[model samples]
Target: MDIINEILSSNILPYVLLGYAISILVVVIMIVLENRNPLKTISWVLVLLLLPGLGFILYIFFGQNFRKEKIIARKGLRNHHRLNNLAYSQISQLTHGSLGDNETARQPTGIVRLLLNNSSSLVTTGNEVTFLNNGKDKFEALLRELKNARHFIHLEYYIFAEDRIGNEVKKILKEKASRGVEVRLIVDDVGSWELKRSFFEEMRNAGVEVYSFLQVRFPLLTSKVNYRNHRKIVVIDGHIGFIGGYNIADRYKEGDAKTYGIWRDTHIMIQGDAVNSLQSIFLTDWYFVSRTELTDPKYFPASQPVSNKVMQIVPSGPDSDWPAIMMGIFHTITSARDYLYIATPYFLPSESVLFALKTAALSGVDVRIIIPEKSDAFITLLCSRSYIREMLEAGVQIYFYQKGFLHAKTVVADDKISIVGSANMDFRSFEQNFEATAFIYDKGAAQEMKATFFKDQSDSEIILLPEWIDRPYIEKVKESFARLFSPLL
Candidate 1:
């Protein structure tokens, strides 16, 4: 009784009560605002209620408006008329009979169509695709193409380290720019944060035009924390283009000086009409980043036949009201006739995606998934493991790549459809973050992608049901806890 009296008499009571009151108030407000999804709202509220101090920090940093409006406003204004009626005409000609139904039809439904319509073009058929497997081959091809530049070169990437590969590429751009090549380079301020201003200064001094995408400045009116341009695109002479799970860094091509051997990644180098789509994407992004009105005829001059590759570029981010890439995935899985193969490093899929894959597998479609045996993020890996049990039980074949981390995001289905891009199969890429992908309807490309997927699968270790069940008790417990926070992951 004396101890209890002393505790009540102490100053801790007031402070504890004050903290409790404030926390409860914030949680209550969050619940009310996010109440439309009762299950999700309750889950988040429980997290906030249980973790106390740290939960508030997580919610503020990650849960709230991570996508700023001013950025959206700028993008909307810059790209307002780009997706007009003329774009539809191009898509109509590109798709032709596939607009209804053909061997390789693109059915971009719902908000995806709206986003496509906004982009001024729907998914076109007949995209010729060349898949570059290693950085050496990729860089060699890029250099060869860039050297042939006649008009302009627009390059954008999330990571552009000033290492060996980057320096070599910079040298080419500088040489071209000095010869009046109209080179425009845009790098993500956050991802390529380490590129010394001096490196850019050299390129600028050599006549290359450069800009940083979404450079977060403090004392800015909007939420200074949200939004990142995580796209990797390169357009050379407005005829050849590249985009995918590749970046401009020595660590990717030939690895860092310390780490030997090349880092395995997939990048697509496309030619023909497809490059125009990439060029449009660059123009819009450049406009938003620099706020400079640019309409140079050389940047997008009247085109003649350069090559014979048919391709469609898919871009997505927060500005749109709908999740564009997610919709594309949903359509692809739903429409799969024979087989569905997915390879991603991260697989924290939304509920709909989880259902689609599971349903596809259960319905006797050969559903297979490949994920890295190890990942860059440990917690996300656990979250991925949490999905394995149910999926395996449903007859979905899960392969853990044993050779090394499988970072490429590719999906090939039944020799008809193929998707390759930087968008990982996760909640963040699907709904929150910026991403781009290419949907290739060419049979030859689909076959090539499928062949490569199987080749990697040979080196993978398929998880057996018994082995999964016999996983250490601690692992099961960890996955359970990790699964709880999946919505927020």
Candidate 2:
């Protein structure tokens, strides 16, 4: 026993013990200071304990919680409190206004109230909403509106590739700028990493202002990588607005056989007071990137009532106290009476969302989710499978879209309410990235979206619980391992 002890207490044992001590210290610090999700905390602790060196590097790059710092700094620069108060006042007035008298408005009032109380999302009425499915229809309508831009055009996208579609849009912006119309564009630096400064030379020369959000510089690693602006927005003359999942890239459009096959997506075009809200979102992002506040009254022209559709623009990011879009989705799910339909490319959900979905399914509400069979991210695809068995056991029906990559982020409930926008049904979108979504409380719009969901379902293959359970042991192992790192993914 003495001989064994001497071997155990050798130099190697001391170094190993020291490494473990450091990892434990880091874990305690993270648990005490970060105050992140319990599952995420546990995951990080496991990573640190199991793989000390690589885990420390990963934590330094991705696991650090700098949301509080960013939120504080952002609020110091922008009048977020003032804007939030304005939105609250508008929501309060609308809640007590004549619109509340209608029975149509009564159904979604709880959701609207939840949004207002949590995120201060302003509810606007008399907006006309047109749902555009797939990129071809969306870009076609957008091009038509671009041609009709009388005053200004503002566009912001996560991915604005310098491809055929991107160059076409740039050409239109240059033409509009040459005609004395203001054209401003914002693209995410990380998402458009492949794009070069020379790609926008023509537009810049034509007087079109362009900027990249959170541009990364070499040798200075930062937390900006986690806080991306994932919103896709287009505002024309402050009267028409477009928001959804379609990015400014050729892959989103048809005929990109080499990249994505028949890219399926959804976007919404709005013509009413809601456009003002969309314009406000774009201008706020523009100010963040360019440091130029667009506060002119011309950008918020008086909007006439186009329809009786009630809409709210819900924007969420690391700047907020909590995940606004995720909470909105939760409220929408818990408020469902008849049916719920959801389609998203990513499927990883936070614990609260997963619980809500399981509870809803177990309560007899028809719950269905559609996801891509072959996702773009292999690890993400594997991680999504970990939750399938649980959800399936709870009576939730899962469909794997077989026709193409399903990139649409849409939710419709009870054929009366719908949410469509850039925020996917995943943790990255809900917690880390800046995202915008439109909550439409209109029976007609909801029915149309439900119909579209059914059409997509026709092309999807339902996953059976028995077959899923019978999947190979290796696949199950992969899924379990992938799920462990899903929080970071």
Candidate 3:
């Protein structure tokens, strides 16, 4: 009784009450000010009311910025006029299937169609894709391309770790900068939190234009923590580009993952007109981060004949109201005629995605999903298991990669279309973080991607329904709880 009385007398309750009230007020103001969907607004309101203190904190960090208007404005300025008529004509052809129609070949309805109509891009195609499986292979190709860069090199990634691979790439960038090559690199401050700022500073000192995306600092202030740029792209001389799930970290290399050993991820080296899409994506993001309109004529010169493969680059994030990447996956999976192959490190999908996969499997599609038997995040792995149970019952073959962590995110459908990029099959990537991907419509590329998936499946153990259900009750409970927060995860 004496301790209770002392605690009450200490005035902690009053301070706590004051803080809670402030948070609630802020959350309400942000929701209303941002003009979010009524359904989503109610969902957020429930979170704030239920969790109280923690909910408000999450809202302050993530809820305030749904659309990055200021960032988009800067991006708009960078390439507002370049490639005007021809680009618009291409966009119309890709979207509407005709020069005058406004519908896209991939998505003909909803927000994506609207985005295509408003932001008419040059629907460039004809590119070749090469799968970079191992870190050594990826590093070698990256170095070779960087060394051959003549005009400029634009690079962006979530994590740029400072290990052997990172340092090697860093040294090249430094050397290239010294040679008067216009080098620009952007890294997410939080994703690369472990990477010492000194590494970036060294690059800056060596003449590389470096910028950090949404640097997080302090405890209770700032809303930059939730908005992360998770796009990995490399454009050299505006002639070739690489986009994929890999990052600049030794952790992705063999003998580098001391715990897992073989790190698996997929990257594509694109050649031809499709490079323009990647270039535009970089310019938009660069303008947002650096606040400088980057329109050096040498970088985005003109589209020339490089390859005969058809490809489309898709970029999505919080800036756009529609969940572009997630919707794209859903559309592709639902449209599969014969086979659907998917590889992802994480599988925490939204309700719509879950439905799409199940529908495809039940509709007689030979659906298959490959995921890491063991993951860096145990909670996510467990949640992924829960989804697999449903998919298995729906006739989807689920494989647990026995080799090591499978971080590659590649989707091949019907041996005609393929999609690959940094976006994972999860809620965070689908709706929250910024992501980029490439859609390919080439027989050669699709066949090669399918072959690689089959190779990995040979070493993977298929997950049986009985085996998944027979797991411990405690594990099931954890998954159920994790699933309940799918929207916010």
Please give each candidate's TM-score. Answer: 0.87, 0.92, 0.87
User: Top lDDT: which candidate number?
Assistant: 2
Error of 3 at 465 (Å): 1.0
Write model 3 residue lDDT over 1-489, tens digit each, in one string.
Answer: 988687678978788678778869776877877775454576677778888678876777766654655334532464755644555555555455554322224433332343344343344544566788877788789989999987789999999988888888989999999999989999998889887767778889999999888778877335567778999999998987999988998787653355665888889888887787788888878888887877777667676556666656777886664667777788788788799999998988777788889999899999999999988887787778778788888999999998878999889988877889999998789877888988776677889999999999997999888988999999889887666555565
Worst 10 residues of 3 by lDDT: 100-109
Relative to the unseen true structure, what is the C-alpha lDDT of residue 120 in candidate 1, on a scale of 0 to 100?
A: 46
Span of 10 residues, lowest total lDDT, candidate 2: 71-80
Candidate 3: give the clashing pairs.
95-103, 95-104, 96-103, 126-309, 126-310, 127-309
**Candidate 1 lDDT tens digits, 38-95:** 5456657767878887776666655664433434553444344554554575456444
Q: lDDT scores for all predictions?
A: 0.75, 0.85, 0.78
What is the C-alpha lDDT profile of model 2 across 169-238, one tens digit per residue? 8889999999999999999889999998797676689899998888777444556666788999999998
CA deviation > 4 Å runs, candidate 3? 1-52, 63-65, 68-71, 74-88, 94-121, 219-221, 255-257
How would the candidate models be sorted by TM-score, starting from the highest? 2, 3, 1
RMSD of each: 4.4, 4.2, 4.0
Query: What local lDDT does model 3 show for residue 261?
Result: 55
Please report how far candidate 1 places residue 4 from its true position, in Å.
23
